[model samples]
Target: MSSTSIIKVQVDDTQFKSFLDLYQEYQEHLESAPDDWKKVGDAIGDAGADMEDFADASKASKEFLLIAATQSEIISREIRKASAANNALLESLTKNVTAQKSFADQAERSEKHMKELKKGASEFAHEIFGLGSFLMRLGALGGSLAGLGGLLSGIGLKDLASSAVDTQRSARGLGMTPGQLTAFNQDFGTRYLDPGVLGSISSAQSSFSGRMWLARAAGENMGQVAGEDPGQLAANLAIRAHNWWVNTPASMRTAEVLQSTGFTQSGFNLNLMKQLGNTPLAELQRAAAQYGSDQGRFNVSDRNTDAWYGFLRQIKDAGNFIETHLTNKLSDLAGPLQHFADAVGKDVTVLIDQIFTPANLNALEDGINGFTKYLGSSQFQQDMKDFAGLVAAVAGAMRKAARFLGIDTSPSSSTNPASIPVNPGLDPDEVQRETRGQVRGYGGVSFADKALGYTRHKLNMPSDPRAVLAEMDAKNGLPAGTLEAMWAKESSEGKNLVGPVLRNGDQAIGDLQFTGAAWKDWGKGGDRWNFMDEAKSGGAYMGFLSKRYQGDIAKALAAYDWGRNVDKTIAQNGANWQKGLPAESMDYIKIAKILNSQKQNVRVTVQNSTAARVAVQIMRPQPNEHFYRLSVSV
Candidate 1:
């Protein structure tokens, strides 16, 4: 399988803003006037009651009454100061939370990238190990050859061959004519073959050396005369014949050559002599060489008595060792050769094992440790964090610019960083004109002027539709509760983005239930996104929809659900537009209409108990009042 690289999850500015908004809301709720504030007032009142009772019981204790009044005033002042301090703290916490979340995002990307690098390094180490093992095996083969070569050097082939060759006599004995013998002797003296080969054979003092010499001679001569390459068996026989011919005394040379040619004295053959005489000189020499070469074939060099034979002993002993101990089963090996082989093999095997032992594996550990050291260093970590921060900052500026120009620059879940929006379409002015539209609210006030915080009454919507809708309306001029209610009807505000695929197998994504094509065209540019990105895409598209349908939310929503078909139906049917559309489209329109109707009853308001509101309420008291009432009645 091909290696898998780690993926980075990008969160753009638009997405961060959405998450920040939600988190801020939760933090606001937490920092609101805690329920225990009432208990402080109740405690003061009880203390005041006790003081009054003590004064009454003591008849003339004005000092106790004065002390009680002073303490109450001081406690009330401290409470006000604490309330102010809490609001400041909440603001500080908000900023820290945003930065920490961004840092966490950077960390995740670094971890995934490191994982990919580690996997690649592991594969490389495995390949290196395999190469090391092969080299070790090759070393073993070389060691075996070196041992055999050492034994061969002990045999003195050079000294023997120097004294042995009488090339002229030997060549003439083989019946080479006077001219032929002279040429042969000249080639022998110049060491055309090997000058020391004759001495090496003579030192062996065995039939085996004689056979080896003749075989070598025949092979050399055969290549010269007929260009016929001799096999191992033919070469062995021919060299032996040459060894015998070269060693014989000069006077007996011709007789030995004739005897080798199959001419026998017991036969007393004048006819044989006549037959030999009839033969041409070249034919007679060739016949004699062949007869002597063939006779040498039966000689066994290593088995017969021979002088100190270093080369032959080394070759013979090593071949036997391999056959008995190495190639064959271990149990079948015998004698000192087997014991020597076992000792060498064991030593080599142990060496190989040591190379890969746990102690040695520290070398491999050092490699991985070095990789991790670089990855986890402060400099590297800071670089990654700084890069993420830079991207977020740049993205924020781009998003702000895009928003000003009315482009839907939002987060996309595409892992490819290139797909993230930097600067979107050309013509910012035209884009703004197409995107943003004026939104009017109750009594002709701009949507931006209206506050929906007061309308946070309980509702059955999946989330707080009034609060979110009001915020969108004020900030982006969306019809209040329109996007929220549309979301409630479409996908319960993105709760089902990953599930409940359409019967046609198309997945509805984001709060507005954008199909794949709709998301591509208007929602945002990505294959996937978090809930915050989905919300931004859904909100951005709603603004564009408002512009397209001339600020008629109901019809624009109908078009959003029905696509171009709604426009076509309306054009053809006029007053009966709903009738001309498909049943699914008609049902979609009904659902959107129902949502629109429900949002009408929802008052545009915010949660009354927010920290800022509670603090203001606490600070505002009647000017003449020395004591403020605490509502501990509940």
Candidate 2:
């Protein structure tokens, strides 16, 4: 109970050892996204379904209008040609009313059918007036209707003046002023996405479908469910109604909104659904939800359908397309991860259960002693010999990933740096400068540590450029993480394989984006297609630049971007060399500050003088490496 004590720790849990254990547990696998994400997918899907229905109805109404107009014109032409008495005869034939009169009746029927079609279509469109974001997505195909963009299409929309009048009349029926409808339509998507609307909107029941669902949920007559209501049905209300329709644990998956909540948007999946033309909506949704897992769409009979469930099924169908690259990505890693585990002599088996360090190395332990004792052992020698092929395998995977991003990979062949064809384009004077020593390839025990560190720290990359980046920085005597952060800013850590490939300027590729000319000179010995090799070549070049600039990071980076032209830039700006650099080069220097923080190494307390020791490590122990311990205390 001393108040002056330096540290006082409170235990929240009796068995808690370290916070890292909790972090490792939670970080083990990807978990389900929050309910808010699911709701977003629901909003998109449900609104899309409404728009799809409206699109179908609008299309039908216009077709009827076009045909009716064509019929009217034909009748008028015939009437002009007819004699007065024959016109009466023609009317008698059409009805036994004349043929012209009968045709006129058909036109009237068509007009009536057009209005009916527009009426139903208006209801769906009006309901979806609350989902403007989904409408914008549809507008990618045809412009948004809110701004009369759909009304202005040069494509097949024949009755603009009449449709506008009908829309105005429908707005009046919904008790919304023209101005209010525009304002309401503009903000519907936002309202649907908000959870707070649930309490207030539940009391304001509106549309027939909304009324029907409310009636069913409360066991009341559909006629009586209309409480002072708004005509628009929000996404949340539809979801609530679906839950009410199917509330049981065993059957909730059969609910419409539950089926609809997934990533595939309507526009993205249109062609997919068209492929299975006339496939049942239930079957399509069921197949799509099964891609990642069976999130069930149509297991129950059609009798389970709620009144508004038809639109909900279409919403779920949109989500069924499920465009994702995660499965392929995971499959790509299975081989590399397994091979690496095997290469490490099985001591690295089962992550989270063991502290994984690369074994069979020449590294000294216990500290830094008996180094290279393992190198003499025959087993350890085989590991070293096998390493070249392992490196090739990992490099091959990196190459594959690079190719996936459409990078024209640089070739890896010539081993000797001297054989690299000289680039006459490089500043000949700078090329001749002292490099201090030959550039080092990451081989030996140090490489093993770095590669394993990448797997432990960064996840899933077959090889991380950061490790290579660190070595590249060191070659120039630049700080560790300096190049890594710059590359992160440059090419998003090599996710962007090539830049300016399409531009009619200097083509660039890989993380550092060494131009074809630059690669020819500085990168001749390395594979521009391979990230690690690209880093080494790029780092060496930057090192050359660093020496020329007297270790001024800004000067070195500016020169890297501007090339030989940076000298002219420096000459122009005089003392303010930074202002002379391009906007991008100045932006590149900002990450140096970012990487500076990364280079601020966190010093951990290490016990050096031994208080305890062990005879064996109990790992896949090498013949001479029997002196492994769990921990040595000082």
Candidate 3:
């Protein structure tokens, strides 16, 4: 649909205003009449009482007073009855007025919608007429031709005409005009072609073109038929006939007319509108005015007037009965309800006041300030600062411990730092100097020396070479400190020889022979275990020996032989030793030979012990102590 075709209907401001005025007047009449009625009734009752009092006086006053009292009572009763009737009439009038106003508003909306629909329909008809005219003219122009060449020319023209008609027809059907169709065709091109048009033109180069010509002729003829206007004479005759039909009275009811009328009656009762009209606001006002002006006499004797007054009093009393009872009950309920309402109102008012007032906002600000003040207190600040400091201290200690353990302790510097080489080239002179200094005399210093030295310095111990070495041995799990402690304890017990003998014979012998030999071999040969080699292999050898010598005397002997051979080799070949060996050559030839020999010897000894009751003796001689021997035959 075109954007312009979308109708936006506006309400009639004047009609709305008039309806609003009527509504306001109706509401005012409804609200004010009850109080006015009550006031009038009260006045009438007061006047009647005054007249009655006068009527009860002496004979000279009796005649005038009785008439006055009678008239007063009559008038009071009439006035009260009139007020009540007027109140009822006013209430009904208000309701009718509201309904009428709503009806008027709805009628206005319906009228606006009707106008929009009529406008749309008129535009649609106009577009259809324009499209039909264009198609009819195009068809007539294209159809006047003959011969093969003429037929081809005619086919082309007819195809063009048919396409134009189809395009126009589609636009018109879709509620668009030729101008809009043209614009759409230009904007969207072949996209807007009717599917039938496209399919017809698709194979039209064959005999389908002839069929298309026939179809086009038929469509064009249909368009012409649709476009034709009826003769003026016929239109005039139709109008005259419609006027005559409308003017003529029905002699007898036709079936269609009867059905239509019955349908109308069923849908809406027309007589109801007429009846409502009779009791409309204007008619009711006229009736009320006439009733007031007539002043028709009701039975006016003194007794009758008294009776009427009594009747009115009874009616008034009846009306007031519920009100009186309600008033008493409501009076009882009023205090509590009013108190509750007051409390609710006060609470609502306080909430509103807090929402709108700056003072409450200031109180909120004060609360926030109090919280901030608490946060900023010396104790809180100090606690936070201490916590931060403690965290820093813990982090620093952790970093120091990691460094002491030779862990990678570098802090992350940046999220995307430049990638640096892990082993950047060192200065050749500095490397050579480090290498030469690192390779000391016959026994090369280890990487553990610096680590051990660091530990000793941190412990605030004397920088003795042996102390550092002892610490290194202990750190490497050699139990040197335990041996020293045991030796000291034995000396204190005057058992010096025992500790020495145990140390030299077994534990110390094992260390000096196995571990010491391995260290010597590592230093001399420049093998992986060689301390002179940058990649020290002694640690690796120890790990291997630890596994091999897991839990047997054979292992201890092997370790001792390994150490002895390593020490002997180091003593034989000085600093320049391992120069002739290939990179992949083994370092344990001598140790292996010694272990093999020891294994064979031990096996023979065990065999001999089993064959003969060989006695094994352990002898120890001490100064100022007897030599003792302990022997066991196995």
Please, what are the lDDT tens digits per residue for candidate 1 over residues 277-321? Answer: 443444434443543443343222322213324434656687688
Which consecutive 10 residues in model 2 have the weakest lDDT in total?
A: 434-443
For model 1 the TM-score comes to: 0.23
TM-score winner between candidates 2 and 3: 2
lDDT leaderboard ranking = 2, 1, 3
Candidates in order, TM-scores: namely 0.23, 0.24, 0.12
Off by over 4 Å in 1: 1-470, 473-476, 499-507, 595-634
Candidate 3 per-residue lDDT over residues 154-244, each given as its tens digit: 4354344444555555544533333344433332233212223322222221244333332232233323322322111112212222333
Per-candidate RMSD, Å? 43.4, 56.1, 64.1
Better of 1 and 3 by TM-score: 1
- State the lDDT at 594 in candidate 1: 61
Q: State the TM-score for model 2.
A: 0.24
What does the lDDT read for residue 471 in candidate 3? 53
Worst 10-residue lDDT window for candidate 3 reads 501-510
Please report the candidate that would top lDDT against the real structure: 2
Stretches > 4 Å off in candidate 2:
1-464, 502-506, 595-634
